[model samples]
Target chain A: MSARTYLDAGGRAPLHPRARQAFDAATDEGWADPRRLHAEGRRARLLLDGARESLAGALGCRTEEVHLSAHHTASLHAAVLAISRGRRRIGARVVVSAVERSAVLAAARFVADETPAGRRTAGLPDGVDTVGVDRWGRVDLDRWQEAVSRRGVALAALQHANGEVGTLQPLGEAYGHARAAGVPLVVDAGASVGHVPVQDTWDALAADPADWGGPAGVAVLAVRSRVRAVRAWPEDEDPWFPGGVSVPAALAAAAALQAVLADRERADPDRRALVDLVRSSVARTVPDVEVVGHADDRLPHIVTFSCLYVDGEALLTELDRRGYAVGSGSACTSGTLEPSHVLGAMGTLTHGNVRLVLPRGTVRDDVERFLHDLPEAVAEVRRMIGATGL
Target chain B: MVDARGLACPLPVIRLAAAARAATPGTVVTVWWTDPAARHDVPAWARMRSHTLVGTCPLEQPADRTGPSGPQAWATTVVVEGPPAAPPD
Candidate 1:
């Protein structure tokens, strides 16, 4: 078989050429301890500082605000916990959008469970209030504002974009609401940092390298300068030191982010057009499909759709067999196939789901071929499952 | 008993709730669901319907036989001690 066109950037990104070179160089020269005061340590610290500055520049924040971590999930856990703890005196509640990443949800559950027994309420046992989303997977602003404005909310989480459906959240509006309510916003930009523009409007931000063709095992957590927490990290421990992320990985991530951002202005239009091609082509060719997400307000690189009466896994297999690598967020079981919470909240069909994430520099030819092949894949899967209403 | 092993949320709870409604009082019904959300949804459904959640046992099955993202499936059993306070209108 010939090479397959990889379209799963949400899962893992193909590293950029510059990122690979930077990784090699940094690994060769940055192995010393950055905490030491020796000459070698000074050199290591300089590299670390440079990486932080580059990442901070990408995120539109000061260098001192950036803290490198081993993974985006860790940063999310730590940030949410820290922010929640910082406001513990004011309130124990943590407000979040219904479609947040699993890590955020898990961390919220943990925090709620840790609340003192005397402070727990019946419906608010977890002290976690979830704001719902619209059918397009975008946060419902009115509902979100109401949840954030609740009397005891400590922190609120809203991702810049939905990794599953590619819906872009209204970060500015959310930030305003959070500010008015005296709550801090923690924005997870893992899916949008390298692919689209990001801002430092939130009180905390979490971004990973995998979304922007950077090396894995490194993520950046930027907490605004004045935000301090007594329990976010142990008092004796360095805030960024969670077993120490690889200096080389951090440098590579920073380099990849800067390289992507530099070309974003020139490349965004073409990238958006390619993504639109997928959206349009899939709709035109595939039968019984409902195109998901906000067509105009979504990420320019990702699109998702669902087919009625079809099995998502079967369709995914057919697409893979046809030399197109895609992803599915469908929850299908032989007994009762369910869609993801995002689709479920939107009340959309969950079966035969397909999420296509075009890489930073995807070729038009491959996208065209994928468009040409997707209909047949869906049809075959539909036939295999004996689905009607084609 | 309902085997919801491959089903996700709302589905597992839906099936289990239906089984509880149809079952005789004081009978235990086992539901096998794969989605992690079922762990919460199932118990919540039982509580809302005034049923007793006996216990849940995690199923150890191979990943392939499970859904696409292979992981452990939950086999939870709940006992129905009374009828639903109000049936769907």
Candidate 2:
């Protein structure tokens, strides 16, 4: 049987060939803990440091600023927890963009639970603030600035680019707003690290290696040295991430990051072209399909669209059956059966949302096949829905 | 008949199971659904319970002539009848 081709990189991107080689080579050696002072531990630590240095160089950050974690989820959680700790004196609230990953949203919700009975917390964290986004998934800077001016916000979290719609946030504007208010900004760069340029306007930034063709588990959280350290629970004074990093995964992640970044300048045009093809094809194929994201400012390899009168989950399955893997907002947010939080925040159609994220080795033929097959799949789904009177 | 037209995954399965229990042997339970996973899920659920799948069809036609959103369009509609055999022991 032939291997399945995955078009849903939003869920997880495939590992790079070089990354796989690094992983295979270090399998036995990466088993040891890096904290131990033994020879094996020292070797593991050296590998981890090398990985960190490579990733840091790609991100245009310092080695000391980058901390590795289990995955993007862990890194984001740790960063959010740290920033919200002991900030009750400033405000019992946290401010986060509505389009953040579920991990960030959950962390904010966790902090919100800790707030002391509604003294006026802004965001998800107790004493934090929450902000909304525009139709293109950009944070409403005017509203955000207004809220910050009124309250002494503790930490502000905004993703560099939305994972679903691929809309690039105004990081420079957001960072300036937060810095002017003396609040630290935590930027989630998970969707746009090597594929797109990393914006350096935030106090701290978090990225996943897998997004850039790296290994899945390794994530980088970059913290400026001068920022006040906010530690997550478990009360580890040393560092929040006590689990010693995996040297091989880190090395693989670094290798992937360096490789993608080195080739980004050349690969970007092709990636953008592919995305445009998907965008135009979907628009032409599906009636009332609104392609989400900024046409120019969006990520090169990602495209999202919402189909009216079609269920997102249903569309995904139909596409999958046709050998085209796609992700939907409905599957991503199902507890309430509402559209994607990002789409909701952006005031876009949420019912039939699907995000097509291209992998590094994706070819033109596959895209053509997907485009050719999508309309049929969508029509099949809509027909199944009994969507009448439309 | 259970209407789970706009529901997501697992919910449809859960609802189908609930409806199935209320049905007697040889009862035709029509499930209206929009989830694409239902194409596989409805059949899988029916097979697991030893029910007989009667029919599955799309609700609407596609707007486009070619592409993924083509003529075989529409979400799915599944009809299953309870088995004549004994229920789970």
Best-fitting candidate, scored by DockQ: 1
Worst 10 residues of 2 chain A by lDDT: A119-128
* Candidate 1 structure quality by residue, lDDT tens digits, A85-140: 88777777888888898899888888887888766643342478988888788888
| Chain A TM-score vs. truth, each candidate | 0.94, 0.92
| Candidate 2 lDDT | 0.75
* Best model number under TM-score: 1
Interface RMSD for candidates 1 onward, in order: 9.1, 12.4
Could you tell me which residue pairs clash in candidate 1? A333-B6, B5-B32
Could you report the DockQ of all the candidates, in the order they appear?
0.04, 0.03
Against the true structure, what is model 2's DockQ?
Answer: 0.03
CA lDDT of A10 in candidate 1? 88
lDDT of 2 at A178: 84
